[model samples]
Target: MCDEKQLQTWAKDTLSRREFGAFSGAAALAACTPGEANGTDANTSEASGDVTESSVSFETEDGTMDAFFVHPSGGPSPAVIFWPDIASIREAKRNMARRLAGEGYAVLVVNPYYRDVAGEQFADFAAWIAADGFDAESGFALVAPWREKLDADAIGRDTAAIVEWLDGQDAVDTSRGVGAEGYCMGGPFTVWSTAAVPERVKAAASFHGGGLVRGDDPKSPHNMLDQAQAEYLIAVAQDDDAAAPDDKAAFAEAAEAAGRPAVVEVYEGDHGWTVPDSPAYAQAAAEKAFADKLELYARAL
Candidate 1:
């Protein structure tokens, strides 16, 4: 089990200042550039054994959220909505989207913190998380002000909007249900989105997601799982289990009791192992976890 001090120390070292600066700089460039106007056009061009990339913005409860969408350039394809970690939309997530597109899936990567900033705003966020030590308390503290500005409800609504938008695209297959994947805070947000619109999401995966189970409030987002219909895959870091063992157990039990398809896999890595930008990233573990994720999507979506 990791104490607050130990956790804080790990977070500090894991979220290095140097890496944060590089991410921040890249985010600034993405924010400044204009995204492709027509998602279909981008995908159609890629369908001929090519890869295409574009960006689009959608209306969320908080405000407008922009996303980088990619896929093969031809016709409607299976869709996957990816939710990024707390660091916001970085190169790793974008690359992942393109890779999925190359695999013949239309991928949409949404900026969960869109309400807080216009485009990529990782630099500001990195500074804040760095100051706060990247712990739960600090995480909430950083997002608190954005609560009224962003609201938890925006998660589901924004995700729904993205799904709707994707379905309308010529590059997406609306008849086939979509899949959702998220990391860190985005992980829980993905689960919330899937539950909010069960009919649309066929598969949902959460990687090192925080708040899967509530610690204090009975009416927390974790309580929303009763409405989930999608098959779920949860990947937990060994250290995170130490902080929320009961919550994790309760979630698994709830899934079983509800007769829902769900599986929880513990990876032998730190909390941010799946994130390439994080200091805690474990390449071997991340590769294995990502393989598991792709397999789940293949079978469920």
Candidate 2:
């Protein structure tokens, strides 16, 4: 399996000029309008107007962590904690959160880099990769420090705090349990959520996430599956699977050994396929992953 640091590096440098409607030049516009290209696809559950959205802040051990919270207006719903990719929280993520909440979930999209900076770190992932001219000028410089602080121990602490805040929210139906999902570097955060709060986090999903399986790391996400009582969905990027084909098998075996149900598959898209504003977004593939996440939550949460 690839090293966690190396896997994150690969995603940071991944860029495609393929014609993506959302990422071509209208990322700002797409961030506000999700599911426009595919016309709401089969995955979207309700109209956007039914979703109540807001910008919320909660105190964590590191400091204040600002996040986007959204849910259906009826009452308490099953909760989902979203960990954004390397670009951190942005409009694109809020769009995704709102959509998730529309499907009967109270979603929280957190800024993974809030320890270093608050608010949107980049306009979107494309801007993040383009920063410093894609590594020549300022790319790594901007993200390296924040990345260093996101190891397993730190993730555990933050997961605890996030779970604590969610447990007491009026919009969260605590009896239903919670689900956590992440993309890219945020992937393992889902697994970490299970270990951080086994009783509350009953479902976890990772989409095109990196570093799920690492041979060298004792605290690899797969290694902690036994500690988490949640069922899992690990969606791998096509290129990521090519790089470490054994990771999925390893994860499946570990899950089975731990008596946890896990669905591990390589979706038909690149690393950033699920996010609408990503240059690599593949509508069909992302819709499939979205459906899987909903199914997991429906059954487990």
Candidate 3:
């Protein structure tokens, strides 16, 4: 969604160029460093031990879907579908998955742009920015075409296929309900995932996801709550909240009307704060968000 580009602009507006440079430098360094030495989220770091990872793919209605799968060495665990932001799957996402896997969950980090391209589109957010000539508009413009193919219906279909693949894996425990978490562009996809396989996906979380409250779309994430059996956690970016202050309330009202439990809050971090490769990475807020996600999964999954 173009809103993703707006989020980038918002981050720039909130932080001076020098400050952003420092954040980006630190994020890049942290991403390159192993474990939690660079002040990565403590929960994510604690869960980073001894997790197995692999590159895998499965057939979807759109095409072959490629993903990075990771899980603990122990017995089968609850499956978690990770829908990455606009940059698509890369080392940052894989590391995030590994951290979650260490927490005893079988994590699948999906390439949301798989329909248009296979494998990693960018090595990281920095790569994407560099490729786009460091222009926000052009950066999002490159993905705008791909976004057209990722509507709620399409994401729901993909989620169904993904859940089926996860269930068939030895690492995934089918007995326990699945969970889905999406970042940026992937956020609304989590709701679509739950709506597609309500029986399997019992929990969903959206971090700074755009298009969640598409009032005109019948299949908007807010409108699909009744179709989902899962509880939700919607973490809004501070700048995004400032731009659309009523969207959070709208989400709360929609969930209440649908009789679905949800926690919708505007977090202190700017857009992309939860992601390690983003210029807006805020360790404190990202850690809080991760803790909240683990709590949600523990309670619902």
Candidate 4:
């Protein structure tokens, strides 16, 4: 849902050039960093201090799915399935997984485009935009096919497979419930995940996610909560809320009707704000969403 217009607005008024460059530089560093001595792959490595991470792959009904798995080295922890935004799996997502892992969760950041591509297609959002010559339409065009295949049913199947894989890992605590978090287009996937395996997934958080309240789609996220046994945190970007002012209300109504607990709020940031490598990243808003995410996990997972 992030377009070139939003990118221009962010650059012109939100994030200064220096700050944007700094974030981009940090993303590049993370993406280019070599694997640690005990890392599992040449290009994938997150092992450090209290957490251990590595690139991993598993088979799904669709194809071989690649992901970044990170967890505390101390012991097994509650598992969390993280669905990254359209940029796919990259260093920024890996860093986010590490942060959640440090909070004592076994975090898995999945590449949503693995059905068509493996590893990172772009190292950061900047790279993604640059590759398209600053035209967001091109970036959208590139992923349109892959994105189309990721309907709620398809993501539900993937979620089942991901949960199976996580349960098999020694780093995951099967006794505890799993948590699900997603951004942008990945947001509705969290709802599908909870519905896929309600027995395992207990909490879900959607940040600046789109298409949550599809008009006639019976499988839309707001319409699927009746199938989930999870609580939710829906962090709507301020601009996104402005565009669809009734969506948050719709979500709240749906949750209440289903007897499910949900916290829906319009964040101060714009779309793509929660991601560190995004041009719209706002520290205060991002941190607030993070805190809300942690609270949901703590209470439900």
Candidate 5:
């Protein structure tokens, strides 16, 4: 794992050197026209649109891991397990979970990087990514090589464990099964988790996910469509298609060939549009995406 202090320093220096315009150029191009907020607010009447927030830890192969848990106060809600982007679990993601819970679902947002750190020290993670730059080559060089030390496999396995735990919880309705959603790196992780325990996941969605297909292996996450027991949705950013057109097609084609119920939508936004804290957040796109995701969970779970 990268040293937290060193990562912070690198991030700060990288941000300092880059002009803000350079970082936000794509976002500026994809900005949504102002409008009313369609989703429930985080700070409203507690019962009407409130979600209880707490922390829970579970044992993984690496060790114990911490995660943010959000759910409704009443009986047995359908559960949704969410994974964060490369920055790991942050306030934005926790808020996302709460909003989903407000919509009447129990949500668990886990820290995939929990092998090394605790909750929401994203500035450090962001600094690491910023200094390293967001590219596959750089990711492998700086990030992927550290996977073993952080027990990356535990991310998928622990997700399955959470599903089992949710099944036993009085607050969750295991009969309906669960839904899984992820963004960016969490996107592929979500699919992998579904494959890990398909019997418990009724729906899976990935937004602007990376690494669906691996060059070195033909049986990557993208090829696991045949193994999915749940309905699937893939939201691809317009810009991302330009870079990984082949992988996107492969994912779609594989799903189709397997006769799975899947829908691939190309949204008019940038890669991080679904995340409000991201530089590329497009309110219009995010709202539509969230609604679509909720509908999928409602039908499948």
Candidate 6:
């Protein structure tokens, strides 16, 4: 069923880190540009031209939270809260949300680090890595303190607030159900969101997310599956899977125990492959992941 109900990886990882970095830098430079990376360009889809975007903020328990919201001019569509990766919200995220809006969904891409920062911390994924000296130790140093502030419990609260705010929007179709999608660290946020607002969020997708099934962490997202009312689409990167070969099965078993339908697949790509701005971007695999995402939303939301 991996080829049917579940999606499959599209291609092999042929690019070395250096080759991948070079290719992604060139591709992302163009793709991250406003109005260029859109999957539904103006000349391509009329819906693309119809999308309206705005920078928005609201009161969460923490503080004033800022976000980018976009949706078709058409009123009342199913809402999707997008949790960006560690790099946070930037041009790439705004463009991504717009493309999804053109597909007939109200998309809100959030700044996960709202407590420490209100806006873009780095220009892009590459910029974030470089700003911290580009090595694992240095990179970890920069995000460590920031990550500490957003524990699983804090994320659960944020998701609740985000959903409540979204429900009040004229663009959101509360009559239907909501969807949530997350990347990298945001991946587990999808699960957390579902557990937080299970009644509203009927579907969720996680791409190349980290620490979903941490053996040492008793309260891992895997353990919270039973709290969700949503079906799931968990796409693991090849490299991440290699590091923890047991996570895929662990997730599957948890979903079965929860009695929720899911599509859990390990794709042939490195971590961050699904996000175009990342040096790890793998076009073929990313496309497959996005296609599966569309399918999951169409059926669930």
> Each prediction's TM-score against the native?
0.79, 0.86, 0.89, 0.90, 0.78, 0.86
lDDT ranking from best candidate downward: 4, 3, 2, 6, 1, 5
lDDT of 1 by residue, 1-301 (tens): 1122333355456656666657554543442223322123422233323657777887755578788888888767889999887666656666657666766788898877676665555434455456566543575566556544433466777877888788888988888778988877677777777776888888888888776776555434456666777888888888888776766677788778766778887889878777655545676887788788788878877
Angstrom error at residue 292, model 6: 0.3
Cα lDDT tens digits for candidate 4, 165-196:
99999999999999999989889899999999
Q: Write the per-residue lDDT of candidate 2 for residues 1-301, one digit (tens) a residue.
A: 2223332254455544232323434654553444422222212334446676666778888888877777887899999999998778766777788778878899988877888887777766656755665443365578889889998888888888888988888989989989999988889989988988998999999998888887757799999988989999999988778888898999999999999999999889877778777666777898899999999999999
Candidate 4 Cα misplacement greater than 4 A, ranges: 1-5, 8-23, 26-46
Better of 1 and 3 by lDDT: 3
For candidate 3, the 10 contiguous residues with the lowest summed lDDT are 36-45
- The order by descending TM-score is 4, 3, 2, 6, 1, 5
Task: Flag clash pairs in model 5.
Answer: none
TM-score of 2: 0.86
The alpha-carbon deviation from the true structure for residue 228 of candidate 5, after best TM-score superposition, in angstroms, is 1.9
lDDT by residue for model 5 (263-294), tens: 87788777777876565577889989999998
Q: Lowest summed-lDDT stretch of 10 residues in model 4?
A: 31-40
- For every model in order, what is the number of clashing pairs? 5, 1, 0, 0, 0, 0
lDDT agreement with native, every candidate: 0.69, 0.78, 0.83, 0.83, 0.68, 0.77
- Model 5 lDDT vs. the true structure? 0.68
In candidate 6, where is summed lDDT lowest over 10 consecutive residues?
Answer: 1-10
Question: How far is each candidate from the true structure, as Cα RMSD in Å?
Answer: 6.0, 5.0, 4.3, 3.7, 6.5, 6.2
Model 3 clashing residue pairs (backbone): none
TM-score of candidate 3 versus the correct structure, residues matched by position: 0.89
